[model samples]
Target: MWWSKSKVSSISSPLPCLCLLWLIVPACEAQQQDLGALLTAKCNSWNTKTTLSFPGDGSFANVTERWTVFAPPMYSAAISPATEEDVVKTVKLAAKYNISFLATGAGHGYGTTLGKLQNGLDIDLSQFKSISVNQSAGTVTVGGGVRMRDVIDAVFKAGFEIQTGSCSCPGFVGATIGAGVGRWSGIFGLIIDALVSVRLVTADGRIVQVSKTSNPDLFWAIRGAGANFGIITSATYRLHKIVAGANGGGQVMNADILVPANMSAAYFNALQSFSGKMPANLAAVSIVRYDADAGAAGILANWDYMGSEADGRRAMAPILALNPPVVSISTVPWNKLFATAGFGIDPVLCENNVIRDLYSANVRNLSASTMQAAFNKMGTFYSDHPEARGSVLELETFPNQAATSVPDGETAYPWRDALGNMIFLFSWDASTNSATSTAATKLGRQLRDDFVKTSGYPDLSVYVSYAHGDEKIEQIYGRNKLPRLAALKKSWDPRNVFAYNNALPTKYP
Candidate 1:
């Protein structure tokens, strides 16, 4: 048991935001004051709105849980700071106690390195879910705890559009820390590109504002490698006016196409045809996974167009020429894309605390032969291990003109030229372990290697958020940018407190 406590009523304190830290010890040490008492005793100075919870507490299970059970960070206690001041105090207190701490923003950050954080403290940022839109300023300020769905809904309500992650469950800021991407990124550029400023609490417990003029060095790093430096309390992003489509403002075309395994090659070749000159308003994602009805692995493609129905049809003419077995196209508001018609993972794969072995690479080129080889391998693997059928290989392609408009050196993110982001996601239950998990991981790595041979980039380029955690630091942050990032790391996070998820070295290796 995590904490053994005989029955007791929840404590309702007034000072420092009623903390409920009951770290009850085992029988032998029951009489004497223990960690539980110490934690409770320190609650006097916390804010009245700030709350602390332990295992077995109400809502603790849900708040502390992560989307991927694989390599989840273990936490003995969690704190939900009601204000930015509470955030600073919480950080200082955690550091004082020598407890490892990781801010939980939607808690969807999935990487094996997170497993290194055992017996840590969860700085839950859920209370920071605030959104402020300045019509006069044409900017949107969102709290750290905001999710993609929240941003989408808020922008749509305010008659503005913002770029964010495609997935609804992941935190908007958390995803942005790794460089956010989504349906509208093709036209607006990366989520980081829309960044205006950030309210940050550094590793040293100092609250500071980061923008182009203020803390310029940290601003550059925060756009890409933010998690390595500090906890972001809030971020300001430049908002764009909603463009009109056939139905109304923010309304666009959403298409779903299903291709049998036999035609996977043709589907990919058609995708490659429009690679270099992909339309500015188009975003495409294809998933290779099992289809029980077909009893084989096939391709499920989501084609998003932010323009007129005629224009969308004209743009997708080549792809529609294939005449796949299943196809659905409709006009949807850009904000509610996932809900009405998304990549189809929003409802099925959004469940929290599920084991998912994932691997990824950001490639500049797409190869039809490589796609076919991997598709066939995935099909065979699905047949061999039907229990692991939730696994999928996803390919995301968006326009690069807006992303590439910014010089590579202007920000730490070096993948402005990457055309497609590929992820090898293998999902299964706890019952499928050992040999089954091993095979899934092995296949995931092999697929990445095979794609690397034709990825067109001189070196491996990885989007840190989807990386499987086995990749070298250079592969994720780029080789040439390391020395400089390391220097910035020294100045900002000298103690290396933020060293869990693809952390940068304090000194160049």
Candidate 2:
């Protein structure tokens, strides 16, 4: 039985509440034991591997730690399945018990959807790591558990290249399923666009293959809103020959510039101008944040050019003319770009247990005045709340030719026309006062609203990957696409078992 709010409200004193919780502990333990026994028995019958971890088990404890520790989901138990068959069994058993379950890849997602899983099962997919490349077909097949770094290294060794996320730690499948945006997106396209096919376990426990020719609707839905459908066991993606650069190597020029707060207006103007005519080989990111050590706010701009140093310099000439302080500019091989892009720190080693609130906006056209106002508000927020000094506003205006080239109706991803993705990331130590975190979250939302208002954007179209869980379904997957997605959800997952991660409703609003 679930604990209802009314039952908790009857306990007037703290002492009674503690006693009540202790009294209910044994019942919860029994439930966990029964669940574990059911999973074990089902796995044995299915002839699959399963490691059932009860609540408080070290494995269970570790599985709950997400990228952001704000409000992680609670699971009665966790299971690590070794093969696709094991995944099928796990899903089937969960459906039999009428239990909701979530498939965790890298645990890098930050949405609040994970927090809603109460007494649910965690289908950990880390054991499914596999990588295979077919040079003749110019394609690569990777397991669901593979990370960006894993695929990148494997493909690089095979004399091919594929688009991947900047952060090498995120699960490759998780990123691509949401229309993965990466450094090479401008030249090649989103990781999803290169998808040849996917081997997934549907909600009904069937191992199915989805592609353009086979199960086309499922294929289109998985390209953008995959997490809502089922668990992907493996996926095949197209790869390209390595580009030629200096000395017969694939070299990319990377530039990092720091702009003073006073130059925010000028910097944005320059960025707007550069983004409007962005070259296919170039990807740019701009960040506005408070540097506590410097006791002032500033802007950082990073440019990635997939070409020789001379071509990169020529492309960046307009922005360079603005004369911001150059932090660094170097040409390195394709694989080393992740390190230079500031993703050098491993996700596990970085600071954990923090409150994070993220919001996104698609910028079709940049308004300098609107951006300047947002920056000024950020300055005020940083000044007033030192605890949130680490917060940042990121504007990514990469060359999205390959992404935009695809017709809007072809996939569930609706932000193809957007030239820039604006992310307002606010964070603070979880140990900080709750009020501080609350204030920071409010400020982030306010900033996003102000940006939309100032920029004259018609609607609130947020990137589903970066959403904070408060956005409407239509906003994430455009208004026109929601009805179809809802219909698909009703057909594929009638019971709504995969109702995590900004879930789509079976019935459209």
Candidate 3:
């Protein structure tokens, strides 16, 4: 959902700040100076590896830049705490000073609600970059600041595998907290399923160990709503043996097929065939974008199968029958999956700070008709506004058996049976006109509503990580998981200090 096809220009250099005691806050300088001085002194004397940066400081931008530039949080200053105790000190200081703060690692948080943090102190977790792989224990422990690439490399080096998002930039713990999903999900389950435990720093700066056995309620909340409770100092996840990789990493059958615009129905129909019976190790993602050469939009299906080439070809026969114009297949290490995945070659697809109005929905079935309608809508949208051609609609397919096997009430993350993650993103350059922006939001919501109507569920089941920040509380967190999450919020974060990530209220009335 975060990747793109257009090339983004390099970000401008960061501004420099030179304040003796903490960075200066542009407004209300008098009051802020006192608070900033106190914060700086307290953090400096902690005897921990902590660093501070102001608005214009060189390191400030590194800690604050995010994947999307739209409506990002504004910070007056930032603190990069080294140890878990240092994290606690940072949080306590922010609370004691009544300064709003947000903890970020990799800063890929895309929710618009994050913009709510104004002139807050940023608790940057980049310093907590530690990875420990226990080959004998079949688990890997990582610092909260570690990104997916860090975990992927460490775990793979140990000849073990862990579920992770496709991209390597997002915080490993941050993504899991949002109920992570990717190509590996069909085999093991959502990233949340692999979670073993986490060292969490609560709203009141209390460092606690949460697991199914200790503080189990908090553990349940962190599985999905961890961001709402506190900062994750560190996390440990269950590891699995590599399936097809013998030479260092596992290999898989990967295919990148480009279906003509007219073949939308056919491709979706083939996808529907595998909905309930999708192979546990087979996964596919159909990205809809403007295929300029065709003078219209089309689907780029990136397929991955953890089986032999013959069996992979057999499994993809239904789709291959479409005679797509551009088809490329290969068998390589799992890390190579994205090397040729849809628009993977474009360096911009993974770059940060591109403006995006992304929306996502969890559909219980691969209804072909509904899928076609949405596909057609996106096709027309691209044609109407050439400047917005970067826009795309994605349909991700993964087996739900592994996830559902755990049963409901197992964790705060709902939608164990969701069959697809339909992500619609409206991407455009900064020069786009306001008309195009309005239409993007207008059509984006319309398409999201349409998908929900035929989603095969009575109400919307939203993937919080991919949410547009406008969905109802019940929609983000399943209705069944709300009350419990609300109580947990009240118990752990009653002050609602961490309310930036599609926040759950202190109380659900």
Among these predicted structures, which one has the highest TM-score?
Answer: 1
Instruction: Candidate 2: list runs displaced more than 4 Å.
Output: 1-33, 42-49, 245-249, 343-353, 454-457
lDDT (C-alpha) at residue 421 in model 2: 77
lDDT values, one for every candidate: 0.81, 0.77, 0.80
What tens-digit string does per-residue lDDT give for candidate 1 at 4-31?
2222224345434223343333432332
Q: Assess candidate 3 and give its TM-score to the true structure.
A: 0.91
RMSD of each: 4.0, 6.9, 6.6
Off by over 4 Å in 1: 1-38, 42-44, 243-248, 342-344
Clashing pairs in 2: none
Query: Comparing candidate 1 with candidate 3, which one achieves the higher lDDT?
Result: 1
Q: What TM-score against the true fold does each predicted structure earn?
A: 0.93, 0.89, 0.91
Count of clashing pairs, candidate 2: 0
The candidate that wins on lDDT is 1
lDDT (Cα, tens digit) per residue for candidate 2, span 306-395: 887788888888788888765678887777777776323335223445566777877777777777887888888888888888788887
In the range 145-255, model 3's lDDT, one tens digit per residue, is 898877877787788777777667788999999889777677788999999999999889899999999999998888878789989989999998775543224767888
Q: Candidate 2's C-alpha lDDT?
A: 0.77
